[model samples]
Target: SFVASGTFSRVFLVHPETAKTRRWKEKSHDAQRYAAKVMRENDSYIQYTSDARKEGDILKRLEASQIAQGKEVLTMRCFDSFAVVDEVGEPYWCLVLEWLG
Candidate 1:
């Protein structure tokens, strides 16, 4: 179900137990929950999609930096990302992130 929305994306809750596919559970391993940030699919959302993709990139860099420094995670981490065609045939960008809550 939809959980939240930001300027560039909408967030959806991903419960491992209820997920239709086992891919998420298998890929995330011990992770039990996730928040997926899906980019808006409208025609004028090009800028929004770019910004959302940048956010995902920055999150990945942050996680890498923390890992390199041997510091405990103090922030949400992204687990996966991909583009999927929506019901309307629009390709929407998606970033799967840790559900800190």
Candidate 2:
């Protein structure tokens, strides 16, 4: 479900099983979940989209900087990103990151 909203996007907390539409009636498994920051598709998307990408880029730079100094970033670790087109043909940019909790 939705966790929060930022200047340009909303965040959703999702589990590994959330990827599939149908749930399996089996034993539960331990897996990593993620916090997805999805870009807002609005009238200002043309400008906000770039800013949204910059957010991920900044996170990567911070982690890279810490790694270069022999340190580890324990928060907001970005995993992957992609664009999902909606029924209205609007492209929503998404950034998948490590969920802190």
Best model per lDDT: 1
Question: Predicted candidate 1: what Cα RMSD to the true structure?
Answer: 6.2
Candidate 2 lDDT = 0.75
Q: Return the number of clashes found in candidate 1.
A: 0
lDDT of 2 by residue, 15-81 (tens): 7654444556654566678998888433254454345566677888888888889887854777777
Shift of residue 13 alpha carbon in model 1, Å: 0.5
The segments of candidate 1 whose C-alpha lies over 4 angstroms from its true place after superposition are 17-31, 41-50
Cα lDDT, all candidates = 0.76, 0.75
Q: Per the 3 Å backbone cut-off, how many clashing residue pairs does candidate 2 have?
A: 0
lDDT of 1 by residue, 1-101 (tens): 89998666788988656446666555555558889889843324545335556667889899999989999877679877787778889778788999876
